[model samples]
Target: MSDMTIGKVAQAVGVGVETIRFYERRGLIEQPLRPKSGGYRVYPDETVQRVQFIRRAQHLGFSLREIAELLSLRASHGTDAIEVRQRATAKLQDVDHKIERLRHIRRGLMALLDRCPGQGPLRCCSIIDALEHDQRLASEPAERKEPDMQTVRLTIKGMHCDGCAEIVRHVLEQQPGVKGCSVSHENGEAKVAVDTSQTSGERLAEAVQGAGYSASLVTEAG
Candidate 1:
């Protein structure tokens, strides 16, 4: 096929012009050199196929980074199919894990809904009470106890936004024996206080991981 201008490439690929530039910036696609005559840069027909491949991979839940790796594998000579298969298998496992986490969230929401009368005043609403109780527990200090109290610092990954930090905080605070937690998406960390007799640092990390983010105990102190 003949080479086409950037506009034609975008039109043919069903994406905006900026999107093509974005792909170039992300290293997912290469931008052709400008013509010596000072004309627009042309794109080869292969660019269309590559952009389509990226879109299809995204639809299948693969992130841009993963798609780049797939493209690299495709461009490599003598690459085995196993490499591609392994990536797909790993992606499938991630999807399954997210599905399970969503199921848990749905069940918890349903339980709250079942307990709610749906028409009561806000103060007496089961849903409101449940949410308020969590907020209070996360902020309030735990009562004095005989058991030793410990604080653990956790480094987390895969949190992309503020909402992710909130989810991690909720998961941490809901754990048994947890007194409070502070989570920050920017720093990708969580500081949790718990009663050592009821829960351990490892268990807290596992709880965060179960919520779909990677977590590891960084430090623990009594």
Candidate 2:
């Protein structure tokens, strides 16, 4: 087998040099020892195949931990095809759940879009009106306000598009005591201003979860 430089190996495998280093760090692939007069570490052709295996496993929704297990199975003399198939089956179920959730989200957005006129004053647009109303309601003062409002940011996963962000913002803003809310699918986060006495970071997370997204508090404002 021909020896290859790190860059050459990465190029051959359609991965970056940093990815190769990361794989080495993750113990997914063994790094060859540097020669005494070496300017860079060299790898055997087998390393390219190993990196490709990692990439394919990732595309199949396997986490690095699971991929490591798969690699272990491959290295063992008594590898079980049934065990690998079981993992893949579980991954398929996860993907199915995600697809179902996405379909529900799509239906909701489509309903909203259907109600929209598609051409009108921004203020009169159905989608814009709904969003604006949510914002206005959220910003309205509570029956008793002592300025205990605080800001909180939460990282939300599964927001696949801008419409998902809008849905998340709308849902969060509807929560009692929310003063304002903003969500960004691109950033995968939601920022909310709420009356801590009437609501809380935990409640905000619950609202986000109800909206069909996984959420964790990123920052809590005092």
Candidate 3:
């Protein structure tokens, strides 16, 4: 068997070196064999293909643990129909759930797009008007006037317009420590200022997603 180093495997697979380390830590891949000759850890050239498999599975929404399970399944039963059927059934259910959600949203949008009042821009958009109402709660004088200077930026997706941006910002601003939050429709970025004493990134992300958006911590640089 041709020996390969971690860097060689990562290079061959088109992934960063750290990604291989993460796969090792996650138990999704095997560790390299460190020979007694001390020529640095050497892996089988097959590791490149394995890393490629992992990246493809991750894109398909398989978690690392699930990928490990899949590897185990493949090792034990390459042609077992029963186990394959069960895995397909579970994955199908996941797909069905997503499809159902999409269908519901499609129906709602059809109504909104067709029933849009022809009065004018401000008066015609039912979506924006509803979101504006949601943010009205923040205008209350009793709320905290200001929050600390700590800023968090969440990388978000699924925002198609200013309405979506407004909706996320309106929802995030309601959190206790969050004095203000704003989403850029152009870039799918959200800038927020919060007081650590009241709310955290977890809290803010939950709040934003709860309203209707996808978000996650991409970075936290000052």
Candidate 4:
């Protein structure tokens, strides 16, 4: 075939051929021509332009769903600069929210660090005591339980907003034997119910902390 194919287009755009198919499936790119002479795939210069636009939007942090919407809008009448600005502004708000929450965690952790010099028994350590106390407090006020469910509460710190809760939930779900996890930013709690025989509270707590959130297991099993 004289004209380039999907493989060639993908190589030119630094993307996998499967990505090109995905873009087509997502309606971000139209199907290329099948030339009569060889019935081979053929890509025009415009296909390259569309591919670059997709890459650029992805680099700008647009989700695939969002990019598809933008591409649809463009195909009809093109997107307004105002709409682009609005999407960007919304993303900024999300980033700002995360930053503000992290700042709160940093302040609390720094204060705890300052109070405790990090050299003492686990019981004598102020930070550990504080963590335990906070964990204990978070365990309360969720007494109601659904049928067929066992409740376990974790005391987690460094959660600034609901997004942190999502992060906690996502991290916990990855662990083996973990059934499900629900994190609450308002209560500073991560409520998880898992197979006791497979997963331990200490291991789950460590996983939560590893996801950039501070957490500890409370002694109260109820």
Candidate 5:
């Protein structure tokens, strides 16, 4: 078939006319020039297929930039399947990491819920207290003695503001053996001092992750 009007192309591709225009603006698709008669901008039939391809890629979690690269690879000569596979593999790994993070978040939330007594004074509510104080509901006994003091550095992600840093600092300080912690949102890192007998770097990392962020132990000091 010959070229189609923008409306017809949108109908064929099951997308809105503005969506096509947006794709054009994003350089995902070309915008045909108006004819000398100046009636309407028409799109080639191939645009329908390309739009479909873009939508399919989006459903597979490919960003517009990645889709553009995929389109370029498709149009380029001597492109290897391995190149496409590598991108897919990277995306898969990203999805897996997100899934694991979500699971960790779920566990943290469930633990909080389990500790909360449904009926209690607002100030005494475990959930409310946890949020207000940045501490877990159930913590280690206060009688535990500190023998070995250690300091650990952690690389944190997803902190966007000063409030997030403050929350992270409080969470660390509230941990069983944690004596103190310094969190910097600008640096995306935290240095924590703890009693090694009660908490390790790994445990500190888990505490940070449980507070709705990603954290990894960078270094440990005795």
Candidate 6:
């Protein structure tokens, strides 16, 4: 490959000229040498391939700094497999976390939609009421007290919004043995007071799943 102009390299990589210049400024890609005759800035053919590499990395969620490190590794002839594998592993973990969070968000939206009548007045809309409050607006006072109440900490998943907390609370409170429930979507936790003799933590988790969410026992008071 011989000398190529910056515009030519950008066109070859399907990127704008400014993008290449920006990468150069970020030290992600090298700037070509200035022409001795002062015609136009020309780059080597290899720069096109490097720009493509950077763009591909960006598409995969690598920050410019990480891409720079990757480029450095690419340039080094003695790059170790372990270093590359570690970066790949870390990226995979990040992607998995993101997928989990999105799944939670989707489930919360579905739960809300399931409660929505979609044809009623805004005041009667269950989804609207859920969003406007942290707890269920229709909760009734406990009719009776339990002789032996247990406190359980549940790790609640599929709670990506404040409304999700409300939904979880509503689900648990509707159960026969449940005294009350408090939930925090941000922390993905629900603390419930229940009649231990009548209901178990697994039952509570099952109820949460019935409400279109996930729950697991973190701790239970005997």
For each candidate, what TM-score against the reference? 0.59, 0.56, 0.49, 0.46, 0.59, 0.58
Candidate 1 structure quality by residue, lDDT tens digits, 1-222: 689987888898799999989999999999999989998898889999999999999999999999999999999996655467556766765787778666667777777878889896788898888887763222222333454456678999999999999999999989987766778899998877666789988999999999999999995342
Predicted candidate 3 versus true structure: per-residue lDDT over 40-141, tens digit per residue:
798887787788888997887677887887778777844343444344445555666677666666766665566567568786577676556653212222
The parts of candidate 5 lying over 4 Å away from their true place are 136-222
Query: Which runs in model 1 stand beyond 4 Å of their true positions?
Result: 135-222
Model 4: residues with Cα > 4 Å off, grouped in runs = 1-3, 33-40, 78-80, 108-116, 119-222
Who is ahead in TM-score, 1 or 3?
A: 1
Which is superior by TM-score, 3 or 5? 5
| Tens digits of per-residue lDDT for model 5, 91-205 | 6656776676666677768888998899958877888777887775343323423256556789999999999999999989889866566788999998776668887888989
| Candidate 2 worst ten-residue window by lDDT | 136-145
* Candidate 6 lDDT, 49-162, residue by residue in tens: 888899999999888998899989888997654455456555655677777666666777777888888896889987878888854433333343324556677998889998
After superposition on all C-alphas, the RMSD of every candidate to the true structure, in Å, is: 17.0, 19.2, 21.7, 20.8, 18.7, 19.3
lDDT score, candidate 3, position 129:
65
Number of the candidate with higher TM-score, 1 or 2: 1
Go through the candidates in order and give the clash count of each.
0, 0, 0, 0, 0, 0
Q: Clash pairs of candidate 6?
A: none
* True lDDT of residue 87, candidate 1: 64
